[model samples]
Target: MTVCEMCGKETEVFSAIIEGSELTVCAACGRFGKMLRKPVMRVVKKQAVEKAPGPVETVVTGFASLIRSAREKAGLTQKDFAMSLNEKESIVQKLENGAFVPPISLAKKLEKLLKIKLVEFEQEDEVSNEKRGSGPLTIGDILNVKK
Candidate 1:
């Protein structure tokens, strides 16, 4: 069943031009506009596409302590380590304090420099039987307008 675009009534719809804009409205609302064609009833079909689980790289838990311990073991102060990494000292401090999460590139650099395992790969959650198709949404469907 198709719904009228203007009045939101579930009935047959006709393609029409109302106030210079096209709308799929019912027969009652169609009188407010110039009818373009015959009434149209749309049939929506949904198909589920299976998605394979993919590998996603993520930082290990307790990364801040791991990085701090590794850096301390390497006998490098935060400032010196930041200088060696070409990053701000504040960023290094934030990383050690668990306030910042490093991107993949930075994590790789840290792993190489500190000789610590920072990134781990895990399989992403697979999505099964997801619905795909629905009718076009009207403005009323999107926004809660007060009368």
Candidate 2:
């Protein structure tokens, strides 16, 4: 029997995309990701196979350092930056501390305000990431999954 990828609970597993990876997980843990509809596969010739892998996207590393440097360079306190982004100071503090991944929306806001690219597309280089450290959960994190 399969188990939940997020919580290690044994139950019916559904294929879902959590963060960027696909996983088979229990219904409750699947609530942490987007439930995907099955994609129809068509058999194609060998030539098409070589072009299948698309561009790889990489998030800029040292995000916390980047945020802290930019904020300090702009002479904005964490509270001030948070207010500008409509986020809480504690969130900014956490982000600058590398406590979690910033949401795409927040990352975009930071890109604009901080004048830095937080994401980049690589045409050739490929990188694979496994699951990260288990961290505390929040309601919003759970609700983000398509149930």
Question: Per-residue lDDT for 69-106 in model 2, tens only?
Answer: 99999999998899999999999999999997797778
RMSD of each: 12.9, 18.4
lDDT of 2 at 80: 89
Off by over 4 Å in 2: 1-52, 123-147
Best by TM-score: 1
Let me know the TM-score candidate 1 reaches against the reference structure. Answer: 0.54
lDDT of 1: 0.87
lDDT for each candidate structure: 0.87, 0.77
Residue 43 lDDT in model 1?
Answer: 75
